[model samples]
Target chain A: MDVYKNLDWEAVEKLKISSGSKIVLKRDLNFLRSEENISVQFLLDGEVKGSVDCHLCLDNKDIDENSRNYLYPYFTESMNILLGRLISTDPMLSALKIKLSPPKCTIYSKTIDSRLMSELVVYSLVINDFDFDVVLNLNLTVIN
Target chain B: MKEIIPLSELRILVVDDSDFSRSMILQILSEAGCQLVTETNSAEHAMKLIREKKPHIVIADIVMPEISGIELTTKINDNFDNIYVIMISSLSQEHVVLEAISSGASDFISKPVQKNQLIESIQKIAQNISKE
Candidate 1:
């Protein structure tokens, strides 16, 4: 099964409702090295097992430390809501019994860990005029 | 005049690993006129706080590091009385909701919780608490 094709973008679009931000899909991987990025990984387990990583970048360079700290959690929670909606609302995902782990945030690094999945290509999600890059490293395999 | 639901009188405890989720929840509760609110990052610590704080309501995230909210609900049901558990999560699957209710949660709420929904849930519980 084509994982990306089967997945529902509408369910993921629930992020817009949660964050009160409009999301636009961008083809370019426009993440800048100069800007500090926040990344978090949510581990998925069950018949389909793997992980989803979200890398978020802010447009405003002048944001203070306190604001950055606040946005970090907001980003994680936004993704958490999106993933949960995807699992529950998506017809394909809801049929399967899947368990999602709590999100584990990591220090911002430009490198994508190749050991998990080779699809380093990211879908840039522009939210509230800021760029949010989502990298899905899901190792999709049916476990019997 | 009908007696108003004393949302301020109900002590609420929020348990979630994400600082953002907790802050959002805190802001919602505060805006809803709830004054006595306590928050914890882990279920283990939540259990400890329950012993000391004895909050009337517990709003917990289903996904966590050490112990999950479901396990915490079971613990609360086994040990405590007159305390209600509201299970909150991004995983809003029917089975997950059933599991939460079966685990002894009084209510289940999906994430990005609406302020009105939360307040209604709390109000229902508050009314019950007032009667007791």
Candidate 2:
């Protein structure tokens, strides 16, 4: 089965959070996406890091300043949910021992890690007007 | 108020590290006519409230700071008698699910929790408790 096809995107789409609510799942790992707003990385056993970013995935850009500050966490939460749901449905991915870190608001574009074998390729999800680049920095052996 | 099987009498505690996730859960619970709902951002506070307030059901995130949902569930099972735990998280790994169920979770709801699943799980646990 195509692993990309197995990843569920329906649940996220059903959540009509507000205006301009939409999500696109890019199967091509190399799929070029836009800038980042929020990113969450899942590090598995110090080897693989599965990163999910909701670059500018906000439905209501017009939300008040106070609401906007509060809303940033929701984007992070969305990325968390996106990755969690992806792993849940896929058996192979779930079997690995992974430690999920708290979501982070990424500023700099994701770059290469020099210490060990890593990769930054996963499904880059673009929602609304924002870009969420998901990079899994791990050996390509795991990808296959 | 219209009578429903899952009444408003359920004292529930919502536990998660995310303010957004907590608010979202509270909104859904309130919409379902839940009267007494408490929100906490982490497992430690949730444990304290579970002791003081003694909620019937706990909707918690599996991955949390300090202690994980699995650890919390184990503690609750070992100490509490009638508390029902429904672990909700963005990560739905098989081991996480297994550990949650083994630790004493009544149900495991994957994050981005759906309304139907949330209601059904709560009601099912309620119904089972009533049967006993």
Candidate 3:
């Protein structure tokens, strides 16, 4: 069974609504070239083994201090909510035991090198007229 | 009528690696009339604070860098009595919840925690503490 197929898409839509953001699926990896990015990764164990990397695209915009304070935590919590919903709400996934490590955040001063990565998913979203991107790199194994 | 434990009287400690989560939890506790609340980003520091503050409830995130929340719960169970742990995490699989419960967590809460759920859990535990 395809793990992606079993994901709870309604959760994704809920995420957009809760964040008050409009999301567009981006086919290219251009979001990786942003000047600054916040990357949060979770380590999965149990029935699923691997890591899920969620990135927030914050380019060279002059964001104010208030925006920075709000956006960072908002983005982190959004990732947590999305991933938690993805695993716990899905019929197939909820039945299987899985552990997600605490999401770890890192800020990059340069563009991410996507050429070396495989199985990348990108979502470009606009929240309050400020553009942000969510990049997911799933390297997973589902134990039968 | 449900006996309302004055949240302000319950000393609580919240441990999470995410600044966002910690702040959100603190805000919730504050609004709910909780007065004594302490927070830490690492489980390592949480242990020291637990020793120092001796809070009635400890809200912990399951995932962390040095020591995971499960380990922390186990440690608390071993060394302390009546220190209820509320485990919070993004993963809600059956085994994960079971593991947390087995590790001595008084309650389990999923991440992006709902305010009512957290308060309810805390209230339940606080009431239990009052009984003992």
Per-candidate TM-score, chain A: 0.69, 0.46, 0.74
Q: By the TM-score metric, which is better: model 1 or model 3?
A: 1
Docking class of 2: medium
Clashing pairs in 1: none
Summing lDDT over every window of 10 consecutive residues in candidate 3 chain B, give the lowest-scoring window.
Answer: B123-132
Question: Between the candidate structures 2 and 3, which one is better when assessed by TM-score?
Answer: 3
Candidate 3 residue-wise lDDT, A1-144, digit = tens? 456655654544444523355455566645355557878788878887888888787777778888877887678766776777678877777888887776677866546656656676677656778767777778777887
Model 3 residue A60 distance off true place after TM-score fit, in angstroms: 6.7
Positional deviation of B1 in candidate 1, in angstroms?
15
Q: What is the DockQ of each candidate?
A: 0.69, 0.57, 0.44
Q: Tens-digit lDDT track for model 2 on A9-104?
A: 443333333234323454553444333233454443322344443344233234566755754675667667766665555455565556566665
Error of 1 at B128 (Å): 1.3
* Candidate 2 runs further than 4 Å off: A1-22, A27-38, A46-64, A106-144, B1-6, B129-132
| Tens digit of per-residue lDDT, candidate 3, span B1-132 | 455457888899999988878987998899899999999999999999999999999999987777999999999999999899999987787788999999999899987777899999998887776622
Among residues 3 or more apart in sequence or in different chains, the pairs in candidate 2 whose N, CA or C atoms overlap within 3 Å are A37-A55, A53-A132, A55-A131, A55-A132, A56-A130, A56-A131, A84-B90, A119-A136, A119-A137, A119-A138
Kindly state the fnat score of candidate 1: 0.87
Candidate 1 lDDT, tens digit per residue, A114-140? 354453434454446555555655545
- Candidate 3: pairs in clash: none
